[model samples]
Target: MLTSKTRLLSLDAFRGFTIAAMFLVNNPGDWGSLYPQLEHAAWSGWTFTDCIFPFFLFIVGVSLHLSLHRKVLADHSETQLLLQLLKRALWIFLIGLALNLIPNFDFQSVRIPGVLQRIALCTALAAPLVVYSSWRGQLLVIMALLAIYSFIMLAVQVPDVEGNLVAAALEPGRDAGAYIDRSVFGNHLWKQSRTWDPEGLLSTLPAVCSVLFGVLTGHWLSAKRDIAEKTVWLFIAGLACLAIGQILASWLMPVNKSLWTPSFAVFMTGWALIVFACFYWLLDASPAIHLKNRMIYLMHPFIMYGMNALFLFTLSGLIAKMLGFIHLPQTDGSQPSLHALLYAPIKALPVSAVNASLLFALLFNLTMLIIAWGMWKKRWFVKV
Candidate 1:
């Protein structure tokens, strides 16, 4: 039923590699990164950096397909399954909250609506929808979500505008997310200024569409069909999405992850599909390549994501804070970073930009990997 062909090593390897890349881009030796890939595109576009989150989300859909495809056992009940789903959602949401609580438990000023929280809600929403809804129904829901978000973005106006509020005047689009979130969560949420967060209430609806696309793909893959046929269909579907997304970008919305526009969702979903195809062909069909071994050895995504996720992120935030405040003596005078402390000294020898980042990222990930490997070996997953 579920997890046929031993969990498709390619998928695992791809997942592991992506998670590692997330760490690399996130924690560079310097914020003044020489590599363009290390930085996220400022706004209104996509980049390899942008692909990281969607890739993880898309793979989440793929993993769902592989994990839950089995026919119900004789003793299993839909009621029981539904309970499991709710429990899973609550568990995931709480884990995200736990991550937020780390280092300091600052609820009053703490920002909510984090990455894990989004994944939790998106996954929970998508799974049940996939389970109960027809593909057409799911498609309609996705369209409805995108349409609603667009309307809100374009048509919604900020109330209480006045001459006194200089910041609001400077940026009128402030508090869009906060207005909605405050109405809903009632101040128990992220306060990222007068306007709402880019990863706010509205963006998530379309983000879930990415997961739905994955579920649809998973369902397609799970169908009783020939491998060649499945691969062909997947490729065609990917191409269709890619084409439609590009066409819709101009008329409907721009490809912006910060905004999480519908066009960006479609584009990311399309690329995810294409990536899945390549993995299926090279890794699944040709076992001689031994890609799974690489993933198992060097990656093991769940171990990385589940364990180092909170730990790595916390470490990263602290590193930034330390670098931001702590000044260091420099040849010229003084710099406001510990990054230059290590970086400048290393330059006393010889190092390229990539080499510096690679060395730093490697050390960073190795530290994470060691922690991850400890948990992996112990079979202890810090699930959120």
Candidate 2:
């Protein structure tokens, strides 16, 4: 069994893989020319891109359980632990807000809801439960949150754009969550759709449950069980969650990432658990020393990326913004953004627009990987 003191290589690699995927989807050379799977589902379904955020949140849950549980066992004060988590959450939220303010420090119309912001909120909300609740209590909280969110989304009526009362509406800007976002954030919603924000307030209720799911998984892993048994049961639990999610999708709420529907949270948690189980079994739980060593060697780059995920995430967003903000003079006397200039060569290649865009994203990930490698070499880990 893996003890609390044993660092899980699998967790780091899984986190690294998710971060790399985030860079790929977020930094595509041409957002308009993306593979369907690379793009978020326009409405009430999911894509590979949609899985990344939930995966990261789930990892946060697992990490929270492992870390906080250890501290609690060590007789640390729960209040102090909570204070530290909230402080970290504040830093993360501020950084996310800072990213939105970049290139145009306009406080008037800047977005307040973002991926990092949502992560911060979820972490803060779940911190107390992880520190103070038992496994059963955490599970009950997850159920309660999901049920409450579903009820609000389905049973609550809200005013639509046309000033008509609509109930059970899941369309853009018409749902209860969207109404709450617009009412609360006003001009501070997502720029793409000012009527609604995907990472808005009410949706965060269910999002916190996503983290709780991961915490439960961590509880199971840290239990005094046989390694093989833990691996088998983890996979089974994931399957159970997947089944439940599908049932909910058909019977109640459809799986919508933007709304962060209960089905979506459960479904994505299932995927995260399954994926993490594979990693845990291969890297930490499995007794195959030679194969485990080989896998670790192969995944060194990801390990580096995972070591400084927050720093890399922030730095990458900053660089991407700069790439779009800075301009270069073109031959036709028209100035193009640095992003356009950099993508020009790849665009000229004899390839489909989608393929070219994918290539650029790959190159961007490689650049980040190189930076991660350097940071890893220098032992520079930026902790919040």
Candidate 3:
């Protein structure tokens, strides 16, 4: 029900940037030698890559808020809206589950908690709360969720490596979240580290706060304030949250993305707000600055990508899987996947291994861009 006039170009642009960044980071030709910024933190810290997933989740909240507002404006019944949102969430989660079964289709070790699954869960949990609560109530829910997660993480105890049930430690494998993941998923967690999964169950509780942060920002964006005034206040609010997050991290918890630590959530939320504010100021707030400028052309590809994000993300994943499935025998009588074959040449580039891997990812993103452009031209948008 959102018309052209109501649509926020800044939101779409930001979402597109996040999707594009995700594609680039995920599809790097060689994971072992990528740039540090592109790689996730080994355990406790964050890289630019760490921000990508949470940014997407936050965008989901914004999209959900806008969609629900449109539904309310259309006079849709709560039952109808609820059913629709539930169906969407379940379908997306199933898609995530199905993605894990790709060329191998091996269910025995398939990952349960994943990017799309997290999105589905966040949206499902946040939609009802947003619909039922006032803005003040939503703010309270955000605070309460963060507080409860912090307490549980700090106060709860589970057996450590020494066979003692004690308070959760801040280390990777020793944390309470890891214990829950191992208990529930058994051998079905992320294979990279059997001891823990980044998208585990307990960590997901704080991730919900990431979505709620977006929900609150969405509400603020749609408020009846003057555009410039809103932009200024958003900047101020973002800086304040950044300070608060830093203080909390320094005093109570380490800002860790894998844990989806409460401080990390607030910290990233601040970044998201500032980024959105900049986009709004440049693209939506000043019509002359946006439309009459040559720079507008640069925004076209990103906007197109945003228009059909879910489809592109899924297709990209499937294509990556298929590419890895096709194998060819090398001159040394060793079999290598198509991806390896393609990357082998890039590997010979007279540059750092990181730059070579980055080039491969850029090539993959270009291919996706072609598909996205085609979809945009045909006005075919696939949404979940």
Q: Which candidate number has the best lDDT?
A: 2
C-alpha displacement of 304 in model 3, angstroms? 0.9
Ranking by lDDT: 2, 3, 1
Off by over 4 Å in 3: 1-5, 287-295, 330-332
Instruction: Mark the regions of model 2 whose C-alpha exceeds 4 Å error after superposition.
Output: 1-4
**TM-score for each candidate, following the candidate numbering:** 0.79, 0.98, 0.95
Task: Write model 1 residue lDDT over 217-316, tens digit each, in one string.
Answer: 8777777778778877878888998888887788877787877778899998888888778766665553454764553454355445544354555455
**Preferred candidate (TM-score higher): 1 or 2:** 2
- Local error of candidate 2 at residue 171 (angstroms): 0.8
For every model in order, what is the number of clashing pairs?
A: 3, 0, 0
* Pairwise TM-score winner, candidates 1 and 3: 3
Q: In angstroms, what RMSD does candidate 1 have relative to the true structure?
A: 4.9
Which residue pairs show backbone clashes in model 3? none
Candidate lDDT (C-alpha), each: 0.67, 0.93, 0.84
The digit string of per-residue lDDT tens for model 2 on 203-252 reads: 99999999999999998888888988999998998899899999999998
